[model samples]
Target: MSTPQNLKLPIPDVLASAICAANRLIQRLAQPWLVQLVLRLAIAVPFWKSGILKWHGFLQLSDTAIDLFTQEFQLHLPGGPYPFPAPAVVAFLSACGEVTFPVLLVLGFGTRFAAAGLILMTCIIELTVPDGWPIHLTWVAMALAIAAWGPGRVSIDYLLGDRNARW
Candidate 1:
């Protein structure tokens, strides 16, 4: 039996060179800044859409939003599926966070803060809709990645000379 590290496959020189060139091209196209921008947009769009639906006008919560929280949503605790405390307040706060955090993420301003907020929101959402864990887990993963990576270059955080900004 050969050790994994000791096993190697021979390749034609032309094939090797082509592979190297393709890798270089891919690396050039997939810059960290671009990847971060895409991640930001991907996570932001869903929340933004949901937030928009919750509002009828500026600062005005839709009846549907309030109704969902009051009648439909519940916290799936160990003992019971509990109704949300102060359902109106919870709905308003959720709507506000869903809108505000995503905008901050897209702008890459206070990126870590925005990501953290999203993570918190996702957890709450998971508790409210336990069956939606698959989607919530994706949101948490993206938020965690953004928080860990911070805003890459080409972001407002980078433009403002944040010391921790990724290059």
Candidate 2:
């Protein structure tokens, strides 16, 4: 039997060069600024959509949003699934956070703060719907990544010379 090291087949010169070229192309396309921008947009969209749905007009929480918080959502914690305290207040705050944080994220203004807000929101969402952990975990991961990295160069933070400052 051939050992693992001896079992490898050699790549053809043309194939090796093609792979290198592809890697170089990918590196060029996936710049840090572009990756950061995409991350900001990707994470912002869902929150923004949810936020807009919650509002009937400026500062107005829709009946559906209020009703959902009061009737449907709960904190699935130890010993009991607790109803959200002050559901109206919670719903209004949630709506505001969902709206405001996404705009900050997309603009890359207060990007880390926005990401941290999203992280907090994700944690609350996880408590509310334990079954949605898969998606919630993804949101947390994106938010944490943004928080750790800060917004990249294509951002208001960068333009204002505040990019390096921890928000």
Candidate 3:
């Protein structure tokens, strides 16, 4: 068989390809993915630690735990179904949720679920609890962003692929 001639790329094709590759690289670098990860991790780690404290304290604050939480922030929750409105189950659940959610969020696994919980909790906190009324709202904003934009490239969400995507 005759050997095929060596292929040569036209100058225009080479230049165009180079420009396209460069543009792609720049776009990746300019993405706010890193910033999102940093922010999520920053909030998640601290939230997880504090949740540990709440978890341990759950036994002592069995009754009116919700009240105590609201009190810690100097606020109150309205009447509602709260695991019988006693035993502080809601408080325990809340603490565990915060801890668990951050872990999921940081790892990018079940990010949607984590974000949803955060949004719900923060909304309640904003509406019912805290001297700092805006604290919950702030978290809510962050949660909304997480929900809307999703975790960045380094997240478990990326690795798990669309099969795990909420959308």
Candidate 4:
């Protein structure tokens, strides 16, 4: 088969050279460790802040949290002795997971598991609060990227010699 001429595009020589230079620059500067560190911090903050709030709520046994769970976040349990258990329990568990997993992620210990947990939590949140999919989806994407790509070089995962390897 002959090469398709249509595939070729006409461009200014300066623009093409600039694009090539940019690509090379990116190749040089885009280190895995730096990117992963950023991703780790970026994803961790939201979970960390939220987890702290939940932990505080758990400590205080906040009425607002209970109300939020009972009215807004009450997950419907299927076919059980009790129709629904205490919302506080669910909130507490979620808070623990959020706090623990994100810390693990930030530390790069159990990085994949932490990212996976966050991903699951993101899914649950997405399902529960469908209206907030845009924000949640971004979280999901970041989690998946971290989960799949690993925590990068500056992480415990790297020091533990599990950067390129999957759990």
Q: Who wins the TM-score comparison? A: 2
Instruction: Please list the C-alpha lDDT of all candidates, in the order they appear.
Output: 0.91, 0.92, 0.68, 0.78
Write one digit per residue (lDDT tens) for candidate 2, span 1-167: 89998876656877999999999999999988898899999999999999999999999999999999999999998987999999999999999999999999999999999999999999999999899999999999999989988899989988988666343
**Residue pair clashes in candidate 1:** none
- The worst-scoring run of ten residues by lDDT in candidate 3 lies at 80-89
Listing every candidate in turn, what is its Cα RMSD in Å to the true structure after a full C-alpha superposition? 5.6, 4.6, 11.4, 6.1
Candidate 3 residue-pair clash tally: 0
Q: What are the runs in model 1 whose C-alpha is more than 4 Å off? A: 1-18, 165-167
- Give the lowest summed-lDDT range of ten residues in model 1: 158-167
lDDT of 4 by residue, 1-167 (tens): 55786565657877899999999999888877777788888999998887777644335545665566667774433442232257778777677887898899888999999999999888777656668889998998888889888988878888988858343
**lDDT value, residue 66 of candidate 1:** 98
Full ranking by TM-score: 2, 1, 4, 3
Instruction: Give the Cα-based TM-score of candidate 1 against the true structure.
Output: 0.86
Better of 3 and 4 by lDDT: 4
Per-prediction TM-score: 0.86, 0.90, 0.62, 0.77
Error of 2 at 109 (Å): 0.6
